[model samples]
Target: MSLENHAEFKLSITKALGDQLAAALKKLAPAPLAMENIRALRPLPGVYQLYKNGHLVYVGKADRSLPQRIEKHFRKISGRRNISLDQMAFTCLYVDEDFGAVAPERLLINEHRGQGQVPWNYNGFGNNDPGKRRDTTEVDEGHFDHDHPIDLEYRLTKLPSQCMEAGEALPLSQLLQETKTHLPYVFRYQASKEFDDIAVEFPDAETTADEALKTIAARLPDKWQITALPGYLIMYPKIEDYPSARRYYRSTGVVDVW
Candidate 1:
């Protein structure tokens, strides 16, 4: 014969704190993630939550200033398509620097892990750039960039320093390198002697990436093509099938080598 008593009390320290933080954040009203709204925020360390259309989607922390960190996100989202800045909102809690060693953002993420909120925390939304090596890699169909690729439309505002004004001719290679540096997203290309020697005149200020690529491609020698991959772009001197390519801009001289 056997007799037993079963009793249990289980709690994780981080999860407990996370639960309380989540509860408190939800109770506070959310404001637009716009600069005007965040401009009023004090430059102090804190944790924050981002919402899309009133639905929680991301959690973050700033060991320095909450305003600066949130502003970075604001500029990034403003350049993308399929999402309106009007749909983004945020809520924040100013925490003592002493409390940050606990990593409040991680704790908050732990609490919401299985709940389907804060999806941006794990998705590529938090990534600034996946880097050049990942350029050839195929993006998962569910990745954030796959759903909302860079808005090449009316997005090429930063011109190369060599050409201060529109309609100025810039060496094709300089244009490629300068654009890669200026764009909020990645722009990768191959190097060649022709790109260095040839100069292409760009269009007006409102010109889009498509227009720019077409201008560049039109000036290139035979067989050159510029392809837009899901997360970035790659330019080469031949037609090639990339599983991740969404669009391709072919050189005007592709039919016959110059």
Candidate 2:
């Protein structure tokens, strides 16, 4: 699809999510705030801001449901006397609803806060400038044929080899796509393997190995399943569902049932 069309398509989905989020907020509140009709909550992906009595305080993002996320915050702070939810009279503003969820949350928070303040949440929002792009990695020649469709097993098996050898970071797909020509086969191979290693190094980055598996699962082809094996990640392709993939990968070699 053309870039314009792709953007338009994403916008449509984002707008739908915003509507759903609005509805979810009404049901979740201790006392429902005035629900304004957000006719076009712009299809862009970004962070959302929640205001209490005109002051910006709570911020979050939802890859799937915005309202559901807002509701979660409301439920958490309903009765608490915390510094974060100091004021009342709630309002939500959709800011930076483009690129995706994770970074937008970071950008909005940083836009309001400078270096001295603690970042609101454990997750970091990427750098604020949307213009700054991320890296993308490609499948190596030996890993998969160019004509073949990219799938989970193909990507996971190929990850350690595809990543930056010494660094702990995994480049986003956009960055990999942009820098494909400059990267060598050995670099790509290392990247592919690095996916799991990065997860290990930053185990705290994800709440748990299952969560990391889910993130990795999202990048894989629809058919592949990710299961935790003893001391490694086991991937199986073309399966409808594997209860095993949901199993937790612990520090121990055994895959524990959740």
Q: In TM-score terms, which candidate is top?
A: 1
lDDT of 1 by residue, 155-215 (tens): 6776754345756677888877766666656676778977888988877776677777777
Off by over 4 Å in 2: 1-46, 82-86, 89-98, 115-258
Tens-digit lDDT track for model 2 on 1-258? Answer: 645544333345544554555454434333223222222334433345555555444456766555555544443333222223345334344444455643555554454465323233422221121120111122233211122211212112223323444444453333323222221111121134333333322113213334434544555444445443211234444342333232432222334343
Cα lDDT computed for each candidate against the true fold: 0.79, 0.36
Kindly give the number of clashing pairs for every candidate.
Answer: 0, 39
Q: What local lDDT score does residue 45 receive in model 2, on the 0 to 100 scale?
A: 37
- Segments of candidate 1 deviating more than 4 angstroms: 1-11, 158-167, 190-196, 220-225, 236-239, 253-258
lDDT of 2: 0.36
